[model samples]
Target: MRSRRAGRTTGPHLRPRLRRHPRPRRSRGTGTRTRTRTRPHTAVLTAVLLLLAGPAGCSGPGARPPADGSAPDAGSRSPSAATGGEDGAGHWRPKPGTPWQWQLSGRVDTSVDVPVYDIDGFENDAETVDRLHADGRKVICYINAGAWEDFRPDRDDFPRAVRGRGNGWPGERWLDIRRTAVLRPLMARRMDMCRDKGFDAVEPDLMDGYLNRTGFPLTARHQLAYNRMLAELAHERGLAVGLKNDLPQIPELVGSFDFAVNEECAEFGECAALTPFVEQDKAVFHAEYALDPDDYCAESERLRLSSLRKKLSLDAWRRPCP
Candidate 1:
């Protein structure tokens, strides 16, 4: 798992920190479903909207397991895999109050009985996505969009000129978002991989690089442009896009993104800032590392945010708001 946007420098890097001590993969077991209010009306609205928006992107053909500790080979795949997204118009739009599980570390425990699952885009293969879809779950692909990691298969594709200072994570550096001409194709490839893997949505991490001490003269305008570009990429691939922790710009970006992914908003007294998304009927998938579910479940329920208590490592364990 990656760090929170607010505590980027201090939040733990779950994978890099445990590279040598990887936890053993656990077999999929039946997950206990959290009791949530069924919103039959909302589901109907979403389905109607999807139909009006045209067909969803096609799932990638066949299940080719990704290599151990690396991304799948994009070179051997057909260019059509990256070309399904026509005009960035029709895409999945998850509504407010949707329950979800975010697991980015260790092997994904797919038994979680929620209607949604968010997992790393590179770590898991097409087979995992197929299984999730088989179980009638919407899968969100997690990608490090605002930063460059040395461990990715396409690491060398990023030029040194675009790499900035470390974002408090090991072997990870912030990318210069202003360099769109250079970064556009790279990010498109990542989104392409997500679409090709049959993901329904995407949660791009570290989107608020401008607010951090990145070694670049980034402005809020630059951040907005880059984030909007990311949303377009996902939509072009016919996948839902999320605004990850850039709360201050929610009012401006709510229309561009399909949903929002937040970290520790309740702890920071910023949960209200995400209301624009909910008010627009978009989901806000949130998590807290330090606070117990008891500390904020009431507020979470009151606000109708999809909130949960998760360990800093962000493994399978989770305590959802009741």
Candidate 2:
């Protein structure tokens, strides 16, 4: 649940994308249905995935969660196989324990000594990314991949059929990611902005909405397909991509992504969920607002996650794990 709301994970809002216009009338009557234990799949979709991302294996045998009923989600498909050859060449792959500054709100304090920065994709422009690169730092462009925010410039581009139930956050609705035929072009354009702006990596947030009450028939397979499509888009453009907070899919996706970005994994006692990224020697860039440095830093350091503590506003001020 991306949100027990009034709690973790309602991040920064996008800057207004267009002049104030009447919101397109939205259909608000979609029914929420109980999802099945297994996601439905067709041969064509599987063939498309195998063609886009080659069959890549898990980073390690131990990285797979146990075969018991306790870890049934472990059977999900991995997006890594498609990340082979030149797909991984042009992007920045952060080290397992790199220090980072995540400030999606307020004027960025570029003087922070961290080697990486995560900032809003819409609010930040090409010059902002260039400045970070000038200081010998890698930059990650943060975008809402699963939800649509009214404030975004391209807000009107979302079709009524694609919008789903509200995500507790005001002016935001989860998009039906299963509609890749429609979403790919739009998301590709957003990634094009990232590439044109000189971003080194991308953090696509709200990807786990399929696990929530998003008034859609989205299955685990749909999420896997959409996420791999995002990865391929980023890779094709020569930009690094992170699998944001879809912890349940880590074992299947760690190889497709260069890193992972998570919120409140520490607060929820779920930091261990990111072990697959670390096992593959990839970074787990984690943040917590509810816990103090004293409460989570030791465990974060032990997990080798590059952890930080910042308010939910995601401003410039921060307390990094020692």
Candidate 3:
């Protein structure tokens, strides 16, 4: 009985031992020992991760990595971008008390050489414009916008349909500004010429044609449309455009122009008309052909106009209001 019990226990124990030690099983279809087996899915995942990591580790040309490895802001990507000023949406309004010189007759006396020049557009050449610019002076191309001057290179370009009564000046006739379709492209070309000549601004003279006997029944709306077109064309070429005279429309047109070049605003008791410009922080360059320097000095000082007295011919002989 004891022998039988020993046999039973030994047999059971040996069977368990044999099962535990049974097979050092080889991998199926290969003579390799079976160990911890990783899945094909795990290998595929590792390969995909490595491929993704390769591109992340590489740097492209002109690209800069953020200091903290965060995504870059929109502005950070473009370092050479301009911030603001004339390149942006800001208007080109020249400051008050800006020194300027005006010469409208004969060959351009580009001799005074101030920070600003009021030069005859028809008489001045591209070289003259460049030389004035090189001297650090802002050039204003003076063009007769209200009247047709016989001396202009484009004198023949004005159609008889647009030309009207004489403007009291010899060889000068008033223009029918109501026809904007014909005049806009002409004036735009003129502004283009000024811009191409390196002029920084345009001084469109005779803007007060509506006030004068222009031979056409020019309403204020017609004048406004024509004037606004001039402003837009000037702005399109990045050039500053000035409002010359046109006292009646100052309140309506002040914002459209960069500066105001008025003739005899003080004489007509219309100095108050130009206050809109001063209030809007725009420069008003006033010149009087009739008034002496001493006569208008105090009034000009009170009104804050860059007032000067000169001959009607507009020579270099400038006499500032005291």
Candidate 4:
């Protein structure tokens, strides 16, 4: 999420750690489940929801159908809790409307009272994760899953052959995700670190590297394969995984991931693209670095998003929607 290198200009990746100048203050910026509900109640609720649903299902309450007009899979809605159904493997599934604190820079201020915390996986250790657990919070380990950062401790682990063009941010380059033979073991170790450190989940950044100019002839199919592999690796360690900023593939990936971490969808008029996750009763941890709460909170709430107003640095400071 950051580079210790001096004078690196921030790039427009999903979350930029630093910018040459602060963005002008204004509006704009950017899962799956098991069934927990009783059948009869679910039936009545489903029927009522369908009766109320309209073509503009993107901005309102209740279940949102896919563009093909198919209903979401059945699951008990737990809007009041951040926790979701635990699969047999004991992976943590965060539900829609879950509150969270995402801090990727500086010493994480664990003082924030929230149900979940997303912190740099390499920066924080097992002790920090234990503290969060003691305080009744789910800790998410953040790592660069699809990109190679020059500053990371395991920078040398990545072979130069897999490195692609710079991913906007200094000292970071997109990884050739298609080469799973090399990446699988490398990313597996990162996921193992999250599980070993007691993290409940993983927030893998740059998941949409295929969509960017990575100097690799990556396609959507390549992205899907790599992202699914990431999810499998996390789940293998009994840790939940999030799809970070890969909107185009949500319909296909919402089932593989336990939740999602997004940035600035509201600003780019792309929030509607995220409805698939919400429809599945999964958490959508969203942040807006530029938009005020008043600008998007209402729609965010209706769509069951866990919305926050954060600085580009993504420090401990946050303005959570009430």
Candidate 5:
């Protein structure tokens, strides 16, 4: 199985010292749902609105919503938009063979000169985004929408009531996605940070948490709602969002997300689930860690996916599909 990091890195003060070890994997087994015990709707609206207001002096051309009250679809014709965002609204439709770089360990390796860069959202700063943009690259902010890490700067903001069983990850727990009144605002703030940092799109991780024993009675509907809210939030911020490895929901979520990012789908024989994105002319950035590059390159090329053989750590070492 391919290993992957499961948490988001926060600010400098909150960033944990990098530990030298194999990447963390999701734990197996079922556990009781442990909801954070708190008032469901407390301080939600005010906090979200306050965050929506751009941070002082950091506003850009697209900072505010358009006067018509309808946000620009990412697929709209905006120079700053991603591939699928040819429409004025911030919709995303990345095409096949899109070049991309994915890094999730330590500090971001911004030196790579790829057209699309996927970096840690909380650890990266506005300057990093600016630098990538200066180099004519589109940046994708990496956020963890499915699990909660104890090291996040906003860790205190998450009431213990919403945290469920541990996600087999150290210091990380599964969140009850059904609690829209709570998770939505938190996720909104994360999205706002991505916007503030000038990311053109977002790649939210741990999206497949619902398939595990999350300790909540979370059904498919709950996951769908949460995922949809995530995409909507990214769109509202004029940022394109990709659907990370939630394969089972591809049929339902393909239209909602601007693109798709998958890990080891070829190994599991589930790559077919991602055909909708390609059929729609949306990019699917796929990666596999366990397979030999030569073995999968031909298949990946046949599918026209921008695939790569990567280490579980997702370092700068990348072998792209031919």
Candidate 6:
């Protein structure tokens, strides 16, 4: 089980490709249905009013991911150094409370009414992105960052030594994040694919490796360094990046990331951990698979988060916090 997103009643963070990790229905074991990931919505999104009137500023060289065993240092390499976003070269930074649509399964549904759309980076091609943009939506590319799935096209690229135990779901394993030197280039290439496809931002899932029971000796610092380097890579490609499901490190990381994507934070009583993004006037894009929008929408509004209700399959249907 990758987590709840990985399987029903289990891990819930990874955004598997077109086909989801299958789980048995009406499980006698847990009295639960199979669960799918409500992928983190991303895009270098801005307010719709501003976006349609102007083009995004995602053009030019930005920052590079730090070398192996390094963290994003304030003095040496901060996200702002490469982005300095007020300038035209940096990518678009989403404003607080930006509206979005997240759909990761079924046929591409472009009919949803939202300014931003987060979809599978590989499953959906450049045409899908162009269609969304023509309809006036910013697109975010979703990729699983911290875990490796056997089904992915790049699965063979990862050496077996770096692959840890399966993460709740079959065919998915937690990666040894300590190997930043190896992951940085792979991740960068993926981010480059997103940029080349015309995506405005990238959402990297399963980023909370430190908190998971992966079969590796990962520390908080290891996670921080790796996550920071991800942000730098996104910025370097002129793509905004969202911090997915890694709530504990929000304070230390909010400045480095462009936005936040979380799952069931409200259900787990951890929504408060995401306020740093809100306080910074950045969008906190959140979703709940099991909770009714009524249960959390009001509080989400108060916190200035763009909260929505999604099924585990993360299809086109969504209930936004009104």
lDDT of 4: 0.71
Per-candidate local distance difference test: 0.69, 0.67, 0.60, 0.71, 0.65, 0.68
Question: TM-score per candidate, in order?
Answer: 0.75, 0.74, 0.70, 0.78, 0.74, 0.75
Give the Cα-based TM-score of candidate 4 against the true structure: 0.78
| Error of model 5, residue 136, in angstroms | 0.9
- Candidate No. with top TM-score: 4
114-188: candidate 5 lDDT, tens digit per residue: 577788887778998898888777889988787787877878888898899875445777889889899899999
Native-to-model Cα distance after best TM-score fit, residue 145 in candidate 6, in Å: 0.7
Cα lDDT tens digits for candidate 2, 1-322: 1211112243443221111121232221242212111121234234433443422111111122223412122211122212222233756777677888888876677877767888878777888888988877788888878887777788899898899986655677879998999899999999998889999888887776666667898777889889999999999988899998765676678889999987666554456667777777788888765555667666776777777666545667666665
For each predicted model, how many residue pairs clash, with residues at least 3 apart or on different chains? 1, 6, 0, 5, 27, 15
lDDT, ranked from best to worst: 4, 1, 6, 2, 5, 3
Compared with the true structure, what per-residue lDDT tens digits does model 6 show for residues 41-124? 122112321333322221122222233412231111111222213224566777667777777765667876667778888667
Model 2 stretches astray by more than 4 angstroms: 1-88
**Candidate 1 lDDT by residue in tens digits, 1-322:** 3633322433235522111122232222222111010111334324533533422111112222222422232212121121112223667777677778888777788777677788888887899999988877789999988888887889999999999987545577889999999999999999999999999989988787776666999887999999999998888888998898776667679899988998776654567667778777788888875565566776776676787766656777676665
**What TM-score would you give candidate 2 relative to the actual structure?**
0.74
State the lDDT at 319 in candidate 3. 58
What candidate 3 gets wrong by more than 4 Å, as runs, is 1-91
Residue 211 shift from truth in candidate 4, angstroms: 1.2
Q: In lDDT terms, how accurate is model 6?
A: 0.68
- Return whichever of 5 and 6 wins on lDDT: 6
- Highest lDDT: give the candidate number: 4
Task: Report the number of backbone clashes for model 1.
Answer: 1
Ranking by TM-score: 4, 6, 1, 5, 2, 3
